[model samples]
Target: MPSATHPSPPDKSRAGPEHDLTAAFPTMDLETPSAIPTSGQCLDHLKLLEAFHVLREDVATTDGLYGIHDRFVDDVYPSKGLDEKEAQLLFRLREKRWAIFVANAERRYTIWFQNLPSDRGRMPGQLALAEMSGYFEKTSGIAFDSGINPPLDILMVWHAHLLNPHDFLEDCIRYDKKLL
Candidate 1:
Protein backbone atom coordinates (compact mmCIF):
# COMPACT_ATOMS: atom_id res chain seq x y z
CA MET A 1 0.00 0.00 0.00
CA PRO A 2 1.20 3.46 -0.98
CA SER A 3 1.71 5.65 2.12
CA ALA A 4 0.09 9.03 1.34
CA THR A 5 1.49 10.70 4.43
CA HIS A 6 4.85 12.33 4.00
CA PRO A 7 7.56 10.77 6.12
CA SER A 8 9.88 13.10 8.00
CA PRO A 9 13.62 12.78 7.80
CA PRO A 10 15.27 10.94 10.71
CA ASP A 11 17.73 13.82 11.20
CA LYS A 12 14.94 16.42 11.12
CA SER A 13 12.75 14.78 13.78
CA ARG A 14 12.23 11.46 15.55
CA ALA A 15 9.31 9.27 14.36
CA GLY A 16 7.01 6.68 16.06
CA PRO A 17 5.34 7.29 19.46
CA GLU A 18 8.01 9.78 20.44
CA HIS A 19 7.10 12.04 17.54
CA ASP A 20 3.34 11.39 17.41
CA LEU A 21 1.30 14.04 19.17
CA THR A 22 -1.10 11.46 20.62
CA ALA A 23 1.82 9.34 21.81
CA ALA A 24 3.74 12.40 22.99
CA PHE A 25 0.79 13.28 25.17
CA PRO A 26 -0.54 9.84 25.88
CA THR A 27 -1.41 10.53 29.47
CA MET A 28 -2.02 13.88 31.07
CA ASP A 29 -1.46 14.22 34.77
CA LEU A 30 -3.97 16.46 36.47
CA GLU A 31 -4.33 17.62 40.05
CA THR A 32 -7.59 16.28 41.40
CA PRO A 33 -9.24 18.29 44.16
CA SER A 34 -10.41 16.09 47.00
CA ALA A 35 -13.41 16.78 49.22
CA ILE A 36 -12.31 17.84 52.72
CA PRO A 37 -14.51 15.55 54.78
CA THR A 38 -15.04 16.66 58.31
CA SER A 39 -17.09 16.17 61.48
CA GLY A 40 -18.21 19.77 61.97
CA GLN A 41 -16.24 21.63 64.62
CA CYS A 42 -16.34 25.12 63.15
CA LEU A 43 -19.85 26.53 63.22
CA ASP A 44 -18.92 29.45 60.98
CA HIS A 45 -17.59 27.14 58.28
CA LEU A 46 -20.75 25.07 58.42
CA LYS A 47 -22.91 28.14 58.15
CA LEU A 48 -20.81 29.57 55.34
CA LEU A 49 -21.04 26.35 53.32
CA GLU A 50 -24.78 26.40 53.71
CA ALA A 51 -24.79 30.00 52.56
CA PHE A 52 -22.62 29.17 49.57
CA HIS A 53 -24.90 26.28 48.70
CA VAL A 54 -27.93 28.51 49.03
CA LEU A 55 -26.20 31.13 46.95
CA ARG A 56 -25.62 28.50 44.30
CA GLU A 57 -29.27 27.56 44.26
CA ASP A 58 -30.41 31.15 44.11
CA VAL A 59 -27.99 32.01 41.33
CA ALA A 60 -28.95 28.91 39.44
CA THR A 61 -32.60 29.77 39.76
CA THR A 62 -31.88 33.21 38.37
CA ASP A 63 -29.87 31.69 35.54
CA GLY A 64 -28.84 28.04 35.42
CA LEU A 65 -25.56 27.36 37.19
CA TYR A 66 -23.82 28.07 33.92
CA GLY A 67 -20.41 29.25 35.01
CA ILE A 68 -20.33 27.91 38.55
CA HIS A 69 -20.19 24.24 39.50
CA ASP A 70 -20.13 22.30 42.73
CA ARG A 71 -16.92 20.87 44.21
CA PHE A 72 -15.78 17.24 43.80
CA VAL A 73 -18.00 15.58 46.41
CA ASP A 74 -19.84 16.00 49.69
CA ASP A 75 -16.76 15.01 51.67
CA VAL A 76 -14.77 18.01 50.49
CA TYR A 77 -17.82 20.24 50.95
CA PRO A 78 -16.13 23.51 50.20
CA SER A 79 -12.94 23.51 48.14
CA LYS A 80 -11.17 26.59 49.45
CA GLY A 81 -8.13 28.56 48.40
CA LEU A 82 -7.47 26.53 45.29
CA ASP A 83 -7.25 29.53 42.94
CA GLU A 84 -6.83 33.23 42.36
CA LYS A 85 -10.59 33.87 42.30
CA GLU A 86 -10.95 32.13 45.66
CA ALA A 87 -8.03 34.16 47.01
CA GLN A 88 -9.87 37.27 45.92
CA LEU A 89 -12.98 35.96 47.64
CA LEU A 90 -11.06 35.42 50.87
CA PHE A 91 -9.52 38.84 50.50
CA ARG A 92 -13.01 40.27 50.29
CA LEU A 93 -14.05 38.21 53.28
CA ARG A 94 -11.26 39.80 55.36
CA GLU A 95 -12.21 43.39 54.69
CA LYS A 96 -12.13 45.81 57.65
CA ARG A 97 -13.67 44.18 60.75
CA TRP A 98 -14.44 41.07 58.71
CA ALA A 99 -10.78 40.16 58.81
CA ILE A 100 -11.27 39.63 62.50
CA PHE A 101 -14.15 37.29 61.75
CA VAL A 102 -12.13 35.30 59.19
CA ALA A 103 -9.13 35.33 61.49
CA ASN A 104 -11.11 33.68 64.24
CA ALA A 105 -13.20 31.70 61.79
CA GLU A 106 -10.20 30.31 59.90
CA ARG A 107 -8.19 29.63 63.03
CA ARG A 108 -11.01 27.52 64.43
CA TYR A 109 -11.77 25.92 61.06
CA THR A 110 -8.15 25.02 60.30
CA ILE A 111 -7.68 23.55 63.75
CA TRP A 112 -10.72 21.37 63.25
CA PHE A 113 -9.77 20.35 59.70
CA GLN A 114 -6.20 19.49 60.72
CA ASN A 115 -7.51 17.32 63.51
CA LEU A 116 -9.61 15.30 61.02
CA PRO A 117 -8.49 11.79 60.13
CA SER A 118 -5.36 12.21 58.00
CA ASP A 119 -6.14 9.06 56.09
CA ARG A 120 -9.19 8.35 53.88
CA GLY A 121 -8.41 4.94 52.43
CA ARG A 122 -10.22 1.61 52.48
CA MET A 123 -12.00 2.52 55.67
CA PRO A 124 -14.45 5.45 55.58
CA GLY A 125 -13.07 8.57 57.23
CA GLN A 126 -14.01 9.59 60.76
CA LEU A 127 -16.22 12.44 59.53
CA ALA A 128 -18.05 10.41 56.87
CA LEU A 129 -18.58 7.43 59.21
CA ALA A 130 -19.98 9.74 61.83
CA GLU A 131 -22.35 11.33 59.33
CA MET A 132 -23.64 7.99 58.05
CA SER A 133 -24.07 6.65 61.57
CA GLY A 134 -26.01 9.80 62.56
CA TYR A 135 -23.48 10.93 65.12
CA PHE A 136 -23.57 14.55 64.00
CA GLU A 137 -27.25 15.34 63.43
CA LYS A 138 -28.92 12.74 65.60
CA THR A 139 -32.33 14.24 64.80
CA SER A 140 -33.68 11.48 62.60
CA GLY A 141 -30.43 11.41 60.52
CA ILE A 142 -30.57 15.02 59.39
CA ALA A 143 -26.83 15.70 59.61
CA PHE A 144 -25.23 18.89 58.41
CA ASP A 145 -23.15 18.32 55.35
CA SER A 146 -19.60 18.93 56.53
CA GLY A 147 -18.44 19.71 53.04
CA ILE A 148 -14.85 19.64 51.74
CA ASN A 149 -14.96 23.14 50.33
CA PRO A 150 -15.60 25.00 53.58
CA PRO A 151 -12.51 23.70 55.34
CA LEU A 152 -10.49 23.89 52.15
CA ASP A 153 -11.51 27.53 52.15
CA ILE A 154 -10.45 27.65 55.78
CA LEU A 155 -7.07 26.16 54.91
CA MET A 156 -6.49 29.00 52.53
CA VAL A 157 -7.79 31.69 54.86
CA TRP A 158 -5.97 30.25 57.87
CA HIS A 159 -2.67 30.01 56.02
CA ALA A 160 -3.04 33.59 54.89
CA HIS A 161 -3.63 34.64 58.51
CA LEU A 162 -0.74 32.43 59.64
CA LEU A 163 1.52 34.31 57.26
CA ASN A 164 1.22 37.24 59.68
CA PRO A 165 -0.43 35.88 62.78
CA HIS A 166 0.65 38.67 65.09
CA ASP A 167 -0.55 41.35 62.71
CA PHE A 168 -3.84 39.56 62.19
CA LEU A 169 -4.22 38.87 65.89
CA GLU A 170 -3.51 42.50 66.59
CA ASP A 171 -6.03 43.49 63.97
CA CYS A 172 -8.55 41.26 65.69
CA ILE A 173 -8.26 43.36 68.87
CA ARG A 174 -11.63 44.53 70.11
CA TYR A 175 -11.45 47.89 71.93
CA ASP A 176 -14.55 46.87 73.89
CA LYS A 177 -12.61 44.04 75.52
CA LYS A 178 -9.91 46.45 76.65
CA LEU A 179 -12.55 48.79 78.16
CA LEU A 180 -13.53 46.01 80.52
Candidate 2:
Protein backbone atom coordinates (compact mmCIF):
# COMPACT_ATOMS: atom_id res chain seq x y z
CA MET A 1 0.00 0.00 0.00
CA PRO A 2 3.04 2.31 0.31
CA SER A 3 3.59 4.81 -2.51
CA ALA A 4 6.96 5.11 -4.33
CA THR A 5 7.63 8.52 -2.72
CA HIS A 6 6.94 7.45 0.90
CA PRO A 7 7.86 3.99 2.06
CA SER A 8 6.56 2.49 5.30
CA PRO A 9 8.86 2.63 8.30
CA PRO A 10 10.91 -0.46 9.05
CA ASP A 11 9.19 -2.94 11.41
CA LYS A 12 10.32 -2.38 14.98
CA SER A 13 9.28 -5.92 15.97
CA ARG A 14 11.97 -7.32 13.66
CA ALA A 15 14.75 -5.18 15.21
CA GLY A 16 16.68 -6.96 17.92
CA PRO A 17 20.11 -8.51 18.61
CA GLU A 18 19.14 -11.63 16.65
CA HIS A 19 17.45 -9.71 13.83
CA ASP A 20 19.19 -9.45 10.50
CA LEU A 21 18.19 -6.31 8.60
CA THR A 22 19.26 -7.78 5.26
CA ALA A 23 16.99 -10.76 5.80
CA ALA A 24 14.11 -8.48 6.79
CA PHE A 25 14.53 -6.35 3.65
CA PRO A 26 16.02 -8.50 0.92
CA THR A 27 15.17 -5.94 -1.80
CA MET A 28 16.83 -3.00 0.02
CA ASP A 29 20.24 -3.72 -1.58
CA LEU A 30 22.35 -2.26 1.26
CA GLU A 31 25.59 -3.39 -0.41
CA THR A 32 25.44 -0.92 -3.28
CA PRO A 33 28.84 0.51 -4.07
CA SER A 34 29.72 4.18 -4.41
CA ALA A 35 32.65 6.40 -5.41
CA ILE A 36 33.37 7.44 -1.85
CA PRO A 37 36.41 6.02 -0.06
CA THR A 38 36.07 3.98 3.13
CA SER A 39 37.06 5.68 6.40
CA GLY A 40 40.38 3.81 6.43
CA GLN A 41 41.18 4.89 2.89
CA CYS A 42 40.26 8.49 3.71
CA LEU A 43 42.54 8.41 6.76
CA ASP A 44 45.43 6.97 4.69
CA HIS A 45 44.97 9.66 2.05
CA LEU A 46 44.89 12.43 4.66
CA LYS A 47 48.05 11.10 6.32
CA LEU A 48 49.82 10.91 2.96
CA LEU A 49 48.83 14.49 2.12
CA GLU A 50 50.04 15.75 5.50
CA ALA A 51 53.33 13.88 5.09
CA PHE A 52 53.79 15.38 1.61
CA HIS A 53 53.29 18.90 2.96
CA VAL A 54 55.71 18.24 5.83
CA LEU A 55 58.38 16.87 3.44
CA ARG A 56 57.97 19.84 1.09
CA GLU A 57 58.32 22.28 3.96
CA ASP A 58 61.36 20.44 5.34
CA VAL A 59 63.09 20.49 1.93
CA ALA A 60 62.38 24.22 1.50
CA THR A 61 63.70 24.98 4.99
CA THR A 62 66.84 22.89 4.40
CA ASP A 63 67.47 24.64 1.10
CA GLY A 64 67.11 28.01 2.74
CA LEU A 65 69.50 27.11 5.58
CA TYR A 66 72.20 25.42 3.45
CA GLY A 67 71.78 27.18 0.08
CA ILE A 68 71.13 23.77 -1.52
CA HIS A 69 69.33 25.35 -4.46
CA ASP A 70 72.23 27.62 -5.33
CA ARG A 71 74.67 24.79 -4.76
CA PHE A 72 72.69 22.53 -7.06
CA VAL A 73 72.71 25.19 -9.80
CA ASP A 74 76.39 25.94 -9.35
CA ASP A 75 77.38 22.28 -9.32
CA VAL A 76 75.23 21.31 -12.28
CA TYR A 77 75.74 24.36 -14.47
CA PRO A 78 78.26 26.90 -13.29
CA SER A 79 78.31 29.10 -16.39
CA LYS A 80 74.56 29.62 -16.92
CA GLY A 81 71.82 29.79 -14.29
CA LEU A 82 68.86 27.45 -14.46
CA ASP A 83 65.77 28.39 -16.46
CA GLU A 84 62.34 28.26 -14.86
CA LYS A 85 61.75 24.71 -16.07
CA GLU A 86 65.14 23.51 -14.80
CA ALA A 87 64.57 25.20 -11.44
CA GLN A 88 61.26 23.42 -11.09
CA LEU A 89 62.94 20.14 -11.99
CA LEU A 90 65.59 20.71 -9.34
CA PHE A 91 62.91 21.32 -6.74
CA ARG A 92 61.11 18.14 -7.79
CA LEU A 93 64.32 16.13 -7.47
CA ARG A 94 64.90 17.40 -3.95
CA GLU A 95 61.28 16.62 -3.05
CA LYS A 96 61.68 13.12 -4.47
CA ARG A 97 64.77 12.53 -2.36
CA TRP A 98 62.95 13.52 0.79
CA ALA A 99 59.97 11.38 -0.18
CA ILE A 100 62.24 8.36 -0.57
CA PHE A 101 63.74 9.00 2.84
CA VAL A 102 60.32 9.20 4.44
CA ALA A 103 59.12 6.12 2.59
CA ASN A 104 62.09 4.11 3.85
CA ALA A 105 61.44 5.22 7.40
CA GLU A 106 57.78 4.21 7.08
CA ARG A 107 58.79 0.80 5.68
CA ARG A 108 61.12 0.25 8.63
CA TYR A 109 58.35 1.23 11.05
CA THR A 110 55.91 -1.14 9.37
CA ILE A 111 58.34 -4.03 9.72
CA TRP A 112 58.91 -3.16 13.33
CA PHE A 113 55.18 -3.03 14.03
CA GLN A 114 54.56 -6.37 12.34
CA ASN A 115 57.22 -8.13 14.41
CA LEU A 116 55.69 -7.16 17.79
CA PRO A 117 54.64 -10.07 20.03
CA SER A 118 50.94 -10.91 19.94
CA ASP A 119 50.63 -12.50 23.38
CA ARG A 120 52.10 -9.62 25.36
CA GLY A 121 49.73 -6.86 26.25
CA ARG A 122 50.65 -3.19 26.80
CA MET A 123 53.58 -3.84 29.10
CA PRO A 124 56.17 -4.24 26.32
CA GLY A 125 54.95 -1.16 24.51
CA GLN A 126 54.93 0.88 27.74
CA LEU A 127 58.48 -0.22 28.48
CA ALA A 128 59.58 0.79 24.98
CA LEU A 129 57.97 4.19 25.46
CA ALA A 130 59.83 4.62 28.72
CA GLU A 131 63.08 3.63 27.08
CA MET A 132 62.50 6.07 24.23
CA SER A 133 61.79 8.86 26.71
CA GLY A 134 64.92 7.99 28.61
CA TYR A 135 66.99 7.96 25.41
CA PHE A 136 65.74 11.44 24.54
CA GLU A 137 66.46 12.73 28.02
CA LYS A 138 69.96 11.30 28.15
CA THR A 139 71.00 12.26 24.62
CA SER A 140 70.19 15.93 24.77
CA GLY A 141 73.41 16.98 23.06
CA ILE A 142 73.85 14.10 20.60
CA ALA A 143 72.66 14.41 17.00
CA PHE A 144 69.82 12.07 16.04
CA ASP A 145 71.78 10.43 13.21
CA SER A 146 75.15 10.56 14.87
CA GLY A 147 76.06 6.90 14.06
CA ILE A 148 73.51 5.64 16.57
CA ASN A 149 69.93 4.52 15.98
CA PRO A 150 67.31 3.96 18.67
CA PRO A 151 66.01 0.39 18.90
CA LEU A 152 63.17 -0.37 16.50
CA ASP A 153 60.79 -1.21 19.37
CA ILE A 154 61.44 2.14 21.04
CA LEU A 155 61.20 3.96 17.73
CA MET A 156 57.86 2.28 16.98
CA VAL A 157 56.32 3.51 20.25
CA TRP A 158 57.86 6.95 19.73
CA HIS A 159 56.42 7.13 16.22
CA ALA A 160 52.94 6.14 17.39
CA HIS A 161 53.11 8.56 20.33
CA LEU A 162 54.18 11.36 17.96
CA LEU A 163 50.99 10.90 15.91
CA ASN A 164 49.09 12.43 18.81
CA PRO A 165 51.09 15.65 18.89
CA HIS A 166 49.19 17.30 21.74
CA ASP A 167 49.58 14.36 24.13
CA PHE A 168 53.20 13.90 23.15
CA LEU A 169 53.96 17.56 23.77
CA GLU A 170 52.19 17.55 27.12
CA ASP A 171 54.02 14.41 28.29
CA CYS A 172 57.34 15.76 27.05
CA ILE A 173 56.87 19.02 28.90
CA ARG A 174 55.78 17.30 32.10
CA TYR A 175 58.30 14.47 32.45
CA ASP A 176 60.87 14.86 29.67
CA LYS A 177 61.45 18.58 29.61
CA LYS A 178 64.90 18.09 28.06
CA LEU A 179 63.25 16.50 24.96
CA LEU A 180 61.49 19.79 24.27
Candidate 3:
Protein backbone atom coordinates (compact mmCIF):
# COMPACT_ATOMS: atom_id res chain seq x y z
CA MET A 1 0.00 0.00 0.00
CA PRO A 2 1.12 3.58 -0.61
CA SER A 3 1.97 5.61 2.48
CA ALA A 4 -0.56 8.18 3.71
CA THR A 5 1.90 10.93 2.82
CA HIS A 6 2.00 9.96 -0.87
CA PRO A 7 -0.92 11.10 -2.98
CA SER A 8 -2.78 8.47 -4.97
CA PRO A 9 -2.75 8.72 -8.76
CA PRO A 10 -5.94 10.15 -10.18
CA ASP A 11 -8.45 7.77 -11.73
CA LYS A 12 -8.40 9.52 -15.10
CA SER A 13 -10.54 6.83 -16.67
CA ARG A 14 -13.46 8.15 -14.69
CA ALA A 15 -12.50 11.80 -14.77
CA GLY A 16 -15.38 14.25 -14.90
CA PRO A 17 -15.89 17.12 -17.37
CA GLU A 18 -13.74 19.36 -15.18
CA HIS A 19 -10.70 17.06 -15.63
CA ASP A 20 -8.05 18.54 -17.93
CA LEU A 21 -6.02 16.03 -19.92
CA THR A 22 -3.63 18.72 -21.23
CA ALA A 23 -2.53 19.53 -17.69
CA ALA A 24 -1.45 15.94 -17.15
CA PHE A 25 0.70 15.92 -20.27
CA PRO A 26 1.94 19.47 -20.66
CA THR A 27 4.25 18.78 -23.59
CA MET A 28 1.55 17.31 -25.81
CA ASP A 29 -0.49 19.62 -28.08
CA LEU A 30 -4.18 19.05 -27.46
CA GLU A 31 -5.61 21.12 -30.37
CA THR A 32 -7.81 18.13 -31.14
CA PRO A 33 -8.86 17.14 -27.63
CA SER A 34 -10.13 13.77 -28.85
CA ALA A 35 -6.52 12.79 -29.53
CA ILE A 36 -5.99 12.44 -25.81
CA PRO A 37 -6.43 8.78 -25.00
CA THR A 38 -8.29 7.79 -21.86
CA SER A 39 -7.18 4.85 -19.72
CA GLY A 40 -9.84 2.72 -21.40
CA GLN A 41 -8.84 3.71 -24.94
CA CYS A 42 -5.26 2.61 -24.49
CA LEU A 43 -3.13 1.09 -21.73
CA ASP A 44 0.31 2.58 -21.15
CA HIS A 45 2.40 -0.24 -19.72
CA LEU A 46 5.40 1.95 -18.91
CA LYS A 47 3.29 4.62 -17.25
CA LEU A 48 1.43 2.00 -15.21
CA LEU A 49 4.71 0.40 -14.13
CA GLU A 50 6.11 3.81 -13.17
CA ALA A 51 3.06 4.51 -11.03
CA PHE A 52 3.42 1.08 -9.43
CA HIS A 53 7.07 1.79 -8.73
CA VAL A 54 6.12 4.97 -6.87
CA LEU A 55 3.52 3.09 -4.82
CA ARG A 56 6.04 0.30 -4.12
CA GLU A 57 8.57 2.79 -2.75
CA ASP A 58 6.05 4.21 -0.30
CA VAL A 59 5.39 0.75 1.15
CA ALA A 60 7.47 0.04 4.28
CA THR A 61 7.52 -3.77 4.54
CA THR A 62 8.39 -6.84 2.54
CA ASP A 63 5.63 -8.20 0.25
CA GLY A 64 4.02 -4.74 0.36
CA LEU A 65 3.66 -4.66 -3.44
CA TYR A 66 1.57 -7.80 -3.43
CA GLY A 67 -2.16 -7.27 -4.06
CA ILE A 68 -1.45 -3.60 -4.77
CA HIS A 69 -4.30 -3.33 -7.31
CA ASP A 70 -6.94 -4.04 -4.67
CA ARG A 71 -5.24 -1.79 -2.15
CA PHE A 72 -5.07 1.07 -4.65
CA VAL A 73 -8.74 0.90 -5.52
CA ASP A 74 -9.78 0.62 -1.90
CA ASP A 75 -7.59 3.52 -0.92
CA VAL A 76 -8.89 5.78 -3.70
CA TYR A 77 -12.54 5.04 -3.07
CA PRO A 78 -12.63 4.60 0.67
CA SER A 79 -16.04 6.15 1.28
CA LYS A 80 -18.13 5.32 -1.78
CA GLY A 81 -17.27 1.89 -3.15
CA LEU A 82 -17.00 1.29 -6.88
CA ASP A 83 -20.11 0.87 -9.01
CA GLU A 84 -20.44 -1.81 -11.71
CA LYS A 85 -18.78 0.34 -14.38
CA GLU A 86 -15.94 1.34 -12.09
CA ALA A 87 -15.51 -2.29 -10.99
CA GLN A 88 -15.08 -3.39 -14.61
CA LEU A 89 -12.52 -0.66 -15.26
CA LEU A 90 -10.60 -1.64 -12.14
CA PHE A 91 -10.64 -5.30 -13.19
CA ARG A 92 -9.06 -4.42 -16.53
CA LEU A 93 -6.44 -2.28 -14.82
CA ARG A 94 -5.59 -5.07 -12.39
CA GLU A 95 -5.25 -7.57 -15.23
CA LYS A 96 -2.87 -5.28 -17.11
CA ARG A 97 -0.77 -4.71 -13.99
CA TRP A 98 -0.52 -8.45 -13.33
CA ALA A 99 0.48 -9.14 -16.94
CA ILE A 100 3.18 -6.45 -16.84
CA PHE A 101 4.66 -7.77 -13.59
CA VAL A 102 4.72 -11.37 -14.84
CA ALA A 103 6.30 -10.38 -18.15
CA ASN A 104 9.07 -8.41 -16.40
CA ALA A 105 9.74 -11.21 -13.95
CA GLU A 106 9.95 -13.71 -16.79
CA ARG A 107 12.36 -11.49 -18.68
CA ARG A 108 14.57 -11.15 -15.59
CA TYR A 109 14.49 -14.90 -15.01
CA THR A 110 15.64 -15.53 -18.58
CA ILE A 111 18.39 -12.93 -18.34
CA TRP A 112 19.63 -14.44 -15.09
CA PHE A 113 20.08 -17.85 -16.72
CA GLN A 114 21.68 -16.34 -19.85
CA ASN A 115 24.31 -14.54 -17.76
CA LEU A 116 25.38 -17.71 -15.94
CA PRO A 117 28.51 -19.59 -17.11
CA SER A 118 27.99 -22.78 -19.14
CA ASP A 119 29.45 -24.92 -16.33
CA ARG A 120 25.86 -25.87 -15.26
CA GLY A 121 26.85 -27.25 -11.87
CA ARG A 122 25.75 -27.01 -8.23
CA MET A 123 28.49 -24.43 -7.60
CA PRO A 124 26.74 -21.70 -9.59
CA GLY A 125 23.46 -22.11 -7.69
CA GLN A 126 25.37 -22.27 -4.41
CA LEU A 127 27.20 -19.06 -5.29
CA ALA A 128 23.94 -17.33 -6.04
CA LEU A 129 22.60 -18.42 -2.66
CA ALA A 130 25.71 -17.11 -0.95
CA GLU A 131 25.50 -13.85 -2.85
CA MET A 132 21.84 -13.49 -1.88
CA SER A 133 22.75 -13.91 1.77
CA GLY A 134 25.46 -11.28 1.45
CA TYR A 135 23.01 -8.93 -0.23
CA PHE A 136 20.57 -9.33 2.66
CA GLU A 137 23.37 -8.71 5.15
CA LYS A 138 24.56 -5.60 3.31
CA THR A 139 21.08 -4.05 3.02
CA SER A 140 19.81 -5.20 6.41
CA GLY A 141 19.20 -1.77 7.92
CA ILE A 142 18.08 0.02 4.75
CA ALA A 143 14.44 0.93 4.24
CA PHE A 144 12.61 -1.07 1.55
CA ASP A 145 12.76 0.57 -1.89
CA SER A 146 11.51 -1.06 -5.08
CA GLY A 147 14.07 0.88 -7.13
CA ILE A 148 16.98 -0.91 -5.48
CA ASN A 149 16.82 -4.32 -7.13
CA PRO A 150 19.32 -7.13 -6.69
CA PRO A 151 20.87 -8.94 -9.63
CA LEU A 152 18.50 -11.51 -11.13
CA ASP A 153 20.57 -14.48 -9.98
CA ILE A 154 20.58 -13.31 -6.37
CA LEU A 155 16.90 -12.45 -6.62
CA MET A 156 16.09 -15.97 -7.83
CA VAL A 157 17.98 -17.44 -4.88
CA TRP A 158 16.22 -15.09 -2.49
CA HIS A 159 12.83 -16.10 -3.90
CA ALA A 160 13.67 -19.77 -3.40
CA HIS A 161 14.92 -19.08 0.13
CA LEU A 162 11.70 -17.26 0.99
CA LEU A 163 9.63 -20.32 0.07
CA ASN A 164 11.04 -22.11 3.11
CA PRO A 165 10.00 -19.57 5.73
CA HIS A 166 11.42 -21.44 8.74
CA ASP A 167 14.87 -21.98 7.27
CA PHE A 168 15.01 -18.46 5.84
CA LEU A 169 14.09 -16.96 9.24
CA GLU A 170 16.62 -19.13 11.04
CA ASP A 171 19.38 -18.16 8.60
CA CYS A 172 18.52 -14.47 8.90
CA ILE A 173 18.59 -14.72 12.68
CA ARG A 174 21.94 -16.47 12.63
CA TYR A 175 23.70 -14.38 9.99
CA ASP A 176 22.00 -10.97 10.13
CA LYS A 177 19.64 -10.38 13.01
CA LYS A 178 18.54 -7.06 11.54
CA LEU A 179 17.13 -8.89 8.48
CA LEU A 180 14.44 -10.42 10.69
Best by TM-score: 2
lDDT of 3 at 80: 66
The runs of at least 3 residues in candidate 2 whose Cα sits more than 4 Å from the true structure, single-residue gaps closed, are 1-48, 64-70, 111-119, 122-127, 134-180
In the range 31-68, model 3's lDDT, one tens digit per residue, is 44575675533433333344444333333222224454
Alpha carbon lDDT of each predicted model? 0.37, 0.45, 0.44
Comparing 1 and 3 by TM-score, which wins? 3
lDDT of 2: 0.45
Candidate 3 residue 47 C-alpha distance from true site, Å? 34
For all predicted structures, in order, the TM-scores are 0.23, 0.35, 0.27
Q: After superposition, how far is residue 150 of candidate 1 from its true place, in Å?
A: 2.2
Q: Order the candidates by lDDT, highest first — what do you get?
A: 2, 3, 1
After TM-score superposition, what is the CA distance of residue 109 in candidate 1 from its true location, in Å?
A: 2.5
Off by over 4 Å in 1: 1-95, 120-144, 151-155, 158-180
Candidate 2, 1-180: lDDT as tens digits: 222232222233534556332232333332556688766555544544444444445544354333344366456655454565445555655655555545655664443333333333332333353454454447433223222244433353455667899987775454433223
- Candidate 1 weakest ten by summed lDDT: 1-10
Q: Show the colliding residue pairs in model 2.
A: none
Model 3: pairs clashing at backbone N, Cα or C within 3 Å? none
